[model samples]
Target: MPVRTSPADAPLRIAVVADSDTRWKWGALTARRIAGRPPELAGFLLRGRATPTPRQLAEVGVAADALREVTMAEFLRAAEREPYDVVVLALVGGAAQAALHGLARLWPGHARRPVLVTGYVGVVYEKLADGLLLRHGADVVLANSRHDAERFRAVYEGVGADAAAVTEAALPFLGGAPHTPEPGRDTVVFAAQPSVPESRADRMYLLRRLIGHARRHPERDVLLKLRSKPGEHTTHIEEQPYQKLARSLDPPPNFRLVYGNMGEVLDRTDLLVTVSSTAALESLHRSVPTAVLTDLGVREALGNHHFIGSGCLASWDQLDAGHRPSPDPRWLAAQGVAPGEAYEGAFDAVRARLAELLARPALAPVSPYYTPVTAPGYLPGILARHHLAPDGTPLPGAAPETEATGVRRLVRDAVRDAARGAYRHGVQRVAPVIRRMGEL
Candidate 1:
């Protein structure tokens, strides 16, 4: 008998594990767009458990009625009972890799798993998870950065990712309409997100200090703008909560919490300010001055000079003195990427690749997920050449064989070592769902 057709009937099962509300919002949007409709949807919020608020529901068109608060374990159980066609997992921070373990435990007996949509957060955790998921089951690993894609293949699980299947995508802004240009106004801007949580604490502090400096220096018209993408595009309002909080005291004439067209705001601006946002990198291509405010966490995560060379990373004192915050604009263009270009091309490529990889001729059901490595016995050997001992033990006594190697030699060794190490001592097992930041 011929079956009736409906977008909801043959929907792909997408499970998102996100570290923040924003990522989850975007992940859910992407899933609905790709999968079609309500009945076919399955999503898991990595953090908050509950249905979307009224505004949240309206923001994404998710049927609040259809949304469920199922745990990772519960989602997995349901997935097995009615086998989803694909699973999209959006993750960030420390929670991403852990979420995969939760998923693996649920499907303890399934053989052929669904296609996975991965949105990884940091380079460190992505590698940790990639080694695991690729070795065990994931059919596809969607990374947000080419660097991350390569890293996943090079170190984590060489065989875990299909080079052809790996698609480098942009970090989606979800629903806010992007900023358009305004006729004539210099509005070079610096972007910081209060919502980024403690991960951006250093940056947050630096921003506050700059605002204080602006109060004293009355000539520079420094604009501090928060990032507002297409999904939740809000008009520039001086009275907004974040702005009110940022500029609690009456600010000086030069400093402002500007709003409206971000593109126009940035395009007209003379300079940009930030810590490690990819936006700072993008502004450089647009020829805006960018500066990075550094502290302990930023220094530890990414070196200062690293972003400075790319543009938009600078010292506040330098910026206060009317000193531009960039060296070469071309370098910025070379490193920075536009979200539209990144998401439209990279993300689409991933979706298409996913469809291709799992096509009938290529499709194969693989595993019931498992994290057998928390204990020493089943641990996958994760041998980082940077710290590998004679017997493959990781420690301070690993001797740092190539830590002091020459530049050319270092690059060569990094490449060579990554491959050799993956083949020799790779042990991390990640869930099929993961992400890579585009800035990498």
Candidate 2:
């Protein structure tokens, strides 16, 4: 018999995967930074940009010449030859994972590989409701705050992620600036909008809070604006209560409504107010006050950091009950975090993780597909999620990322009687050809 070399079963392959969108840059940039770190990790980078620059790549503190940028297709083919070390799917949209898993069909032997996933839990702690639903993709989670870490641990283990095996890393450095603001201004300006609202009533309730806040404070003028995030349309903003409140209010406009040219506009603004906004950190470093408002009964997920105090953000009732109106100095300590320094620290932590994962012995993927999803080989729902077609009209000019995937196929399955029915009489021996097909 011809020997089967078992090339499909080998050491883990480490690849940084991401969508084609602009955010993919985060993973690539971070991976590049890691590749340029310590010597042990430099070897595991295997493929990605060599940190620093082409000229600076040589001085990356170690020898790492083999690493280079790779397309998703190229990666799928390469994994067929050797197992991967890790696949970091940084911050990517849901559609990206579908394509990544579909591409996994090209190489079918990595079912048990480790996947480090990072994304919001999409949990909305409304003022008076329980954390509505548990979210996934936070499976192997990397959370920055204590609440997020605890909540995620509860979520993943609830879904069976060998919580013991999962490593929880404290990510003090993962935070980002919402925007730069004027110095020494203590006034609070809230810039926030929840992407997904569970219901219209909940949405309107939050809106009324903002409007009520603005209306009650005869002095302090509040500004309500939407951050200019990519793929967000003004129409989406126009549909919100911010617009409706604008139409409803009489002449004494306490709140200023803003929509476009946000970055420039934010430069002149002071304190930022909202619910656990990444922007609050930006306001902090800029010497502006930030108050994270927790509606009526919602849990305040954004807690006070060692550098920033809880005072920045307040609950709606607290505003009514009267609390000391002062910004937390803890955040002032955060003023020390330089833009470049935080990025460097983040890169260092990531490199350390890569080094630890790659130095260990290799193992075959749980299945031939290193990506998410339980089964491989002619799996349905998995590939169908990719949302691509042979023609690209839905996506405009370019060709579809995927073609006709066809029907799902099954390799093998075992059955047992759940109903206590007449199993002995209902079951029968398979015919010769049918038995042969099963063997085949």
Residue-level lDDT tens digits of model 1 in 184-207? 444436665433323334444655
Question: Per-residue lDDT of 196-291 in model 2, one digit per residue for the tens?
Answer: 232335556656666777777756566766543222221112123345434654424666666543234446665466665444544554445456
Q: CA shift at 237, candidate 1, in angstroms?
A: 26
RMSD of each: 16.2, 16.8
TM-score of 1: 0.58
* Count of steric clashes across candidates, in order: 36, 30
TM-score, one value per model: 0.58, 0.48
